[model samples]
Structure formats: C-alpha cells, structure tokens
Target: MLYAGTRHRDYTLRVPLAGDLVDAQEAHPQGLVRLVALDLYRRQLLQLGEIPAEAITLELLRSELTEIDMAELERADAELGKRFAPPRPGSSTGAASSTPSSVTATPSPTSGA
Candidate 1:
C-alpha cells in the first residue's frame, strides 16, 4: 500500500506490510498486528517528515514501536478501522453505500484515548 500522509505532505510511504496487513485486518478481525503496523507507518512518516524517499525503511519503523505502545496503537487502530472499513458482506447499514472510500489517501485524527 502506498500511503500518503497528510494531504499537505508530498511524500508517499510504501508499506511493505500493506497486503498482509489488509488480509489480517479482514480475516483476523480481532488481531492487533494490522493496527500496530498502521500506527507505526503513520508515526514513522510524521517523525521523519520530508526525508529522502529511500530513508523509509522497515527497520526504522520497527525501532519506533514498543510493547507499551501496543495498547494505545491497538485502540487507535480499531477506531480508525471502524471509521474507515467497508461494511461487511450482506450487512445492513448506510456505510455500505459509501463502500470503497479511500483508506490510504490520508491519515485521520483517531482519538488516542
């Protein structure tokens, strides 16, 4: 997944985990890995804003996450997913009408509480 940061930022992040993360997100709905990965990617980009394209590496991202941050990231990730995830198949909700909204377009402010 090529994630664009805030709309104002010109850089794009190539998330290597995008495929597996989406798979886990839909398949293992209760898992936190996808959420963690999402938070890590966002933080990595924000922390290193306007850097060279080649500077965005998996190691740099992994280095920023800790076990203590997992709980917060998990919560934020769940909230972000809930707000953005497409309605499940055969569900009855207005969100179903808005399916296919761009998830990788920009980062939203998910309450960290």
Candidate 2:
C-alpha cells in the first residue's frame, strides 16, 4: 500500500502487487510503468484501511489521489494507448489515425473488358 500525501494521510493505494506485475508483463511486453500503475490501481484500490476493492473507480482514483501524482498518471494513461493495449483486428498501433478518408479504386486501362 502507498501513502499519497506528504504527511501520509488516510488516502492510500495497494496496487501493483506481484500478480499485477506478472499480469501486466503477460499482457504488455514493454511494461510502461505509469500506464500499468493506473490500470492496476483501478483494480486493486483506493484504500483507507479496509476499503473494498469494488470501491475503486476511475473517477474515485482521480479524485482521491494527490493532484501531483494524478497529473502524471493521467498523461501516461492517455499517451499511446496501443503501446500497452492489446491490438485488435484492423487496429492501428500508432497514436494517430491511420485510416484514410477517401480511397478510390480504379480499374486499370490495360484490363481487357
């Protein structure tokens, strides 16, 4: 569990345990730290002693965590989502849109019709 404030207030996190690291490694080979931390915290906690795991939500994590830490976490979460995310069929790996808006198909003049 990690204490958030300078004075180590009640708001805390119990994220990124051994299993979480193993799972992240299995899913994302490169293992970007902040990105994985965000994801794991969503699952593990926003603990204040005995806070239930179900209490974890993106909104709560953002609101509960220290402002300084959330800034970095948010940036990491938003940067290059595909880098940590599993690729789907026809999905672009890059951060930008790869799909062209207007593709045209023209039959070759050499075609014997």
Highest-scoring model, TM-score? 1
- Clash list (residue pairs), candidate 1: none
* Candidate 2 lDDT for residue 68: 56
Candidate 1 per-residue lDDT, tens place, 1-113, comes to 12244212232222224565555456547757645465454543422334444655554434543444434445544655576667799987753364464333233333121
TM-score of 1: 0.34
Regions of candidate 1 where Cα sits further than 4 Å from its true position = 1-18, 21-48, 65-76, 84-91, 95-100, 105-113
TM for every model, in the order presented, reads 0.34, 0.31
Colliding pairs, model 2: none
Predictions in order: lDDT: 0.44, 0.45
Predicted candidate 2 versus true structure: per-residue lDDT over 9-104, tens digit per residue: 233333235686566556656757755665565643344334455655555554556655455333433432433346898976667567653211
Candidate 2, lDDT over the whole model:
0.45
